[model samples]
Target: MNILLKMLLSMSIASVILIPLVWFLKKVFGQFLTKRKSYYAWGVVFFFLIVPFAFFFVQKNTEFLWGTPSEFAGLTSMVIGQNGIEVERSTQAVIFQFIMDYVWVLWLMVGLIMLVYRIASYRNFKKFVISGAHYIEEPDELDILAEAMETIGLNKPVEVMINPLISSPVFFGFRREIIVLPSTSFSKKELYHIFLHELVHCKSKDMYVVFLAQIFTCIYWFNPLMYWMIRQLERDREYACDESVLSYLPARDALSYGDTLLHSIVKSGTYKESHAAVSLHENAKMLKERLEAIASYKKGKKGYISFLLLLILLTLIGILLNFYEAKAFIYEKKQGIEIKKEDTSKKTEFRAIDLQNANQDVTIRKGKTESFDLTTYDENSKAELVVKNGILMYKNANPNTQSAIIITIDADKVYDSLSIQTTGTQIKISDIHTKTMRIKGGVIIAHFNQIKADTINVTTGSANVHLTDSEVNKGMKFNGNNALIHFEKSSFNNLEMTSFLSAKLNDLNVQGGLSINSGGQLDARNITTDTLKLIAGNSGNMKFQNTFVKKSSEFQDNESMLLQFDGVLNGQTRMSIGPSQTKFVIRDKMQKYAIDAQSSQADTFILNQSIVNYPFTQNLSAPNNITLTNDSPFNNNFNLSFEE
Candidate 1:
């Protein structure tokens, strides 16, 4: 997902930069270079679009010291955070798999549908060309076309066919070029200009340009800018053909050629409506632009140096902006140094997680997997500490009776991941730094003052979790039922929390993004998230306050007990507040807002600021539709306010 998004975003940035550059060049240097040269400038922009994807495929992944590509790194940083929160190899693989299975499939499906539609349209046009057209047998007309082709140094035989359905002369096919002309009568001078224009199209291989444009258009139909680029390319192709045809004509006959072009265009209903071929006439406005160019032709020396220099510079810039350093160890586990334990008689063993039944109060912390110190107190209870692989386990020897056991853990002595599962266990852990912490099926009360981990996964039937002054780099996942999760002065880069029956969140702050799925009541306070996605079942209410949101937030059938924003909202927000009788209180009067409300019943709007006003505020008692917009030009100050 990250790589795909980066490739797309890089291409967008390149296009946004290169298109304007080309447009400016054309506007300023149109007179210096011939239209044929201007038409070729668009190839630079096309190359810019492909640079990012090309770099993505061939770029090598490096170590931690490897830096991101300068151009695309900025865009990636803007979304993924500056510190680059590192996820486990398994987690990264899962995310990549999900995207490949779902998102990529959808994109390809839509693209294929569009391609099929275009191919069908093209085939229908081919059928028309084969059925409704006849080869022109006029010796004089055929000789004129052959002579024009000969003058252009062309040797390929192109059939000249006439069709009444066509509005203008079309140069069709690349490998087998064919000219399709309208069935209207043409004067000798008109035939001369038309033959030269279509023949120039064939000579310049503009049909190949049309074919490539069609293919790209079908593939990138989802991007509006691509369609616009293809349109611009087609317009320039015609301009280039016009310039080529006019250059061969005598200076005195330029006006005659322009008149013949204009008459054919007017008789073709002011535009060419064909899609499968390039027409001699495009539209009245485009024809006018071409006519203006022809009228002001100066036959100056073509500035090949300036054009080539611009193309080379733009290509280098594209390459620089699209490439980034990739991490070589993305699929490997992190390594850590080992520590020696006090018991020299037998070395502590490294192991994976121990999931056997344990009936002891265990305080587990991070330590080196190769060595661990297990200390036990209250010897009468017969508490045992077992070490296997890397996991350190404490189990009460007698499980038939209630036995009180206390285990003190010293994880700072070594580097190891911690896993704790206990029944009716009072676990107190503090000042623990580990790679990951996994808690499952425990009535555990864990307190941490300074805990740092790559990830924390908690799965409990019911538990209370609290942390202060702690930070998880990658993220934290909570899976439980009726869990009370609270954090004070702590943060996670990403959070995927799921709870059912009932769950409460107190002062939870996510630095990156958050995803929540619950079937119970949520009490949220002082929550800050870069982006939030919430899915809730029918029963519970959502409560929020002092929340800061960035980018966007989505709510699905959320029924809240109370909703209010006391902090800042910086982006677009979508809410589907279900039948929860929701009311929003906005205390910040300085934020700009655009509110679109739809309901069969009238909704109240209380605007207290003079800088903001809604015209439909008076229709609160009647069923009405209201749109409130704070049309402020300034960014530092907001103009809307809402309060009850």
Candidate 2:
């Protein structure tokens, strides 16, 4: 129950509790926070309070439990308590400490990065406002906008306000209460089209999402992806809106709306109202974006396949958000209890010593560069393990078993290896070398390192693993039935592996790589990195994907290679190749890519996918490209497809 309370409390702090705080800030310093206050009161306040603590707490607790004592505790706890004095021997008190070893400091820096990002988000939300459209209202335009509104069956009594101080299209603002326009134009059809667009924003109640995203932004400022998700949500909302509007409006009129949007682009560079919501101030870039979107826009409802893909993406994201833990610890100290990073010394801390028997909490501390190992028989104990200075401590208790490790090092150095004997179902730890940390377990979560380990091994059972940092290094292999691994940030080299819960590698940077082996289910998304190697063996879901990079050109134009393969292409030859430049930033299931090819490949990348709203680049290039195309197209084929 205590453990449950802590878990609930921590989650509340990161989300529910945190969002309100962001709201409070907006209220308290509305005017002060911004000269450009767009959703200032709502977005920043929510994001500010929740993102930092939620991310930090989860990262910290997981690291601390890197290697605690669980297997032994479960095996002996029942028999030992009854025969207390007889159990003098197992592994001496697993002298496990915290996970901040000299080697892990680099990873720990990630926490700082998140902090920096959140702070900037806070500052940005408070500062940025839409402003660039030169509203050329020609007076009496309200009647036209209002008449158009009625034609669309919108009779909720809309407000037609003339913003002599404003600029841009007929905007629907703050809950769709006001529709402002340029004193000059818009025909009945044109006006109706514009109304439909803005109304779509309102119908979807994007106003609410804009508010929600603001909250997320302020808190998770460091995670660029989070912000991108917000934009994506808005973009999707617009796409969905566009589809809805198409139901009533004609093609030519819709095209006119697109044209008018372009004209507005010519007039306004881009005006952000400094509020939480984004309104109609379409600029040149946005104009081009809208054109491209409309050009590829389908007329009717999306099919099951489209929805299935959407569901998969949403499900994967939700799973990541839900099945996460944030463990904590407490501590009391001893003099010079020298601990080693590799020693399981204080394995069970006087197995003879029981919390009920001891008058006070156990206290164990060590000198500089020390370490400890631990195991927990209680389910409650597995979640949080904290240490003060050099001491190891825990609270409450659990009857279920788990294991973890604590290795304390300078916040300035790095480490080499973290090995876990496959014993319990879970292993929690942090701060270590960027090397391969092998574990024989069912569930795994590691935090912040350069070259992260792979394989959350299980002999015959099942395992689920998640790692986080800049990218994924190597991912998990399913030797058993339902063994699954999920890597965040770093690189991957899994050409083949199989299973029910399979391994998922995400956020492979422009520098990261992924290799999908045969018969293995490898789903790669959000590969923001440039060069990656993919080899989908005989049969498997080697889904090549990418996401738009929010990074500037100075940082993106790196000479990286992205290689993928499966079958033949360019012709029916044994093998084929072509020139291309398509890079992906692999997220768990959502990947965005920038493809620049003169002709489309039937078996290459499935085009006309979810309506993606991103600027196109002319400088994109990919020279050494492989093709997975065959004589006949590979429809819904999971295996590889080389594009020539």
Model 1: weakest 10-residue lDDT segment is 70-79
Q: Which candidate achieves the best lDDT against the true structure?
A: 1
Winning model by TM-score: 1
lDDT of each: 0.63, 0.40
- Where model 2 places Cα greater than 4 Å from the true spot, the runs are 1-143, 164-167, 170-176, 267-271, 316-644
lDDT of 1 by residue, 359-391 (tens): 545554443333333344445666556665556
Candidate 2 lDDT, 1-644, residue by residue in tens: 32322333344434443343334443454333221122322333333333323334444323323333333321222333554533222343333322222323543365467556645653463333223223335444556556556656666655544433344543434533555554344555655666666765555556666656665454344445455545544544554555566656666556666675666544432334433444564345655765676665445443444334433443343333433433333222223422224555444222111112111112222225444444544545433444433233344434243434343443233324333343343444444433443444333332234333442232324555555663224544434345566766755443223443455666755433222333446566665533333333333444444433222211111111222322111111112222223232222211122233222334343333332221212222332222222222222221222232
- Cα lDDT of candidate 2 equals 0.40
